[model samples]
Target: MGIMKDFKSFAMRGNVVDLAVAVVIGGAFGKIIASFVNDVLMPPIGLLLGGADFSNLKVVLKAGSEAILNGDAVVTPAVAEVAIKYGSFVNTVVDFTIVAFAIFMVIKAIEKTKKKEAAKPAAPPAPSKEEVLLSEIRDILKEKQ
Candidate 1:
């Protein structure tokens, strides 16, 4: 009961809710960035660097055991296989870069806003007459001693 109530209160806090929302939005933003990189940005870049598809980029390591075609060098069209896909790595790198840049910009904007907010002067507290008298007495004592 006590634990449940505490959990409820914590979950209902504004910061926690804001964080949950941010996580969801950030995930969606990452997907959008990944799609933009794979679908838009990479295509043109790949074309410019000669028509090389990043998705098909890979290293054929070992070429797998047990070759089919009954002692033939040529591999047939239909065959179960495994390949080291380095092209996917390139795509992932691009996606990471885009998402990282987006997150960096968001953090930079948030910091800028925080700095602007911090620059505003807070209201000064009213001083009491007793404090003023104490200061004056201290000054007089300093002058004398």
Candidate 2:
């Protein structure tokens, strides 16, 4: 029970909770970026590059063959094509670039706000006791005059 309570406390800490929220939001943001890269960005780029589909782009390392059979009895199973899918890699790189740029912009904006806050002049400090006493004595002398 003590261990459970400790675990709960650790998990419910502000930093821990904030980290969890960040992970969830980061996952969703990644999906949105991937969709933008795959659906919106790639199509126009593909069209410009002579209708080449990036996802389907690959270099066949070994040519695959159909199942070998004798009298409809399979002697060998169907072999799958093995290839380097570089188009998917390209899309992934683009997604990473966009995400990095977005995080950079967010950091820049945060820093800008921090600088603005720091640049504002602080409120002047309250007068010391001696200054207050001095001012009161000066006012008393003025009254006498």
Candidate 3:
């Protein structure tokens, strides 16, 4: 069918393939940034702020469903059935900041390259042999005058 052929053509486009690859790479890059924020950056920050664990940070809303410990003791693990995680939010903020900064740097570099290209002067056209000969004749005539 013509529709199927058109669809195939669209799917096989280089731009589409490149976009797909970029999306996959972007996902992986996001994971790397998240890990860098959580594992590398947050630890020092948490230590500086009195050993606060951001991931375990939460607000108790319903005091959590009771957990049975030792088959007899009911323990509520700080219920956050409807809680806001400010620490995880901070971690996500850091991740977003890093990714944003990297993208900004890349865009800045690209803009710099574009500016350099724009600033470059075009090469002058080469002089023809006839023009060179004419210039020599003119110089001789001027000297004689």
Candidate 4:
């Protein structure tokens, strides 16, 4: 029960909740970026590159083999193809770059806002009526002395 209560309190903390929200939003943002890269950005780039598809680009390291089965006897097993998928890596790198730039811009904007707020001078507080009266009395006392 105590552990449950502790967990509830921890989960309900402002920073923890904010982090969870950030994680969810970040995931959505990543998906949007991925869609943008794959659907929108890649097509134009591919067209510019003479209609080359990045996803399909790979270096076949080893050729795949088909399995041969005859009369419930397997002669050879099916082997999967091994390749270096550099095109997908490129797409991922681009996605990461865009996300990093976006986050950097957001942080920069936030910092700029904070700096602006901090740069403005705060207005001085007004003295209370009692303080004013006390000052006047003190002045009178000083003049008498």
Best by lDDT: 2
How do the residues 18-63 of candidate 1 rate in per-residue lDDT, one tens digit apiece? 9999999988988898889889998998999899889889888646
Model 4 agreement with the true structure over 73-105: per-residue lDDT tens digits:
998989999999999998999899999999999
Q: What digit string (tens of lDDT, one per residue) describes model 2 on residues 1-145?
A: 9999999999999999999999999999999999999999999999999999999999999888899999989998989999999999999999999999999999999999999999999999999999999999999999999
Sort by TM-score, best first: what order? 2, 4, 3, 1
TM-score of each: 0.66, 0.88, 0.74, 0.84
Name the weakest run of 10 consecutive residues (lDDT summed) in model 2.
Answer: 63-72
Where does candidate 1 stray beyond 4 Å?
1-7, 62-79, 123-145
Residue pairs that clash (backbone atoms under 3 angstroms), model 1? none
Better of 1 and 3 by TM-score: 3
Output the TM-score of candidate 1. Answer: 0.66
Using lDDT as the measure, name the better of candidate 3 and candidate 4: 4
What are the lDDT figures for the candidates, one per model? 0.87, 0.97, 0.88, 0.95
lDDT of 4 at 65: 91
Write down the worst ten-residue block by lDDT for model 3.
71-80
Identify the runs in model 3 with alpha carbons over 4 angstroms from their true place: 67-80, 126-145
lDDT of 3 at 24: 100
Tell me how candidate 2 scores on lDDT. 0.97
By the lDDT metric, which is better: model 1 or model 2?
2
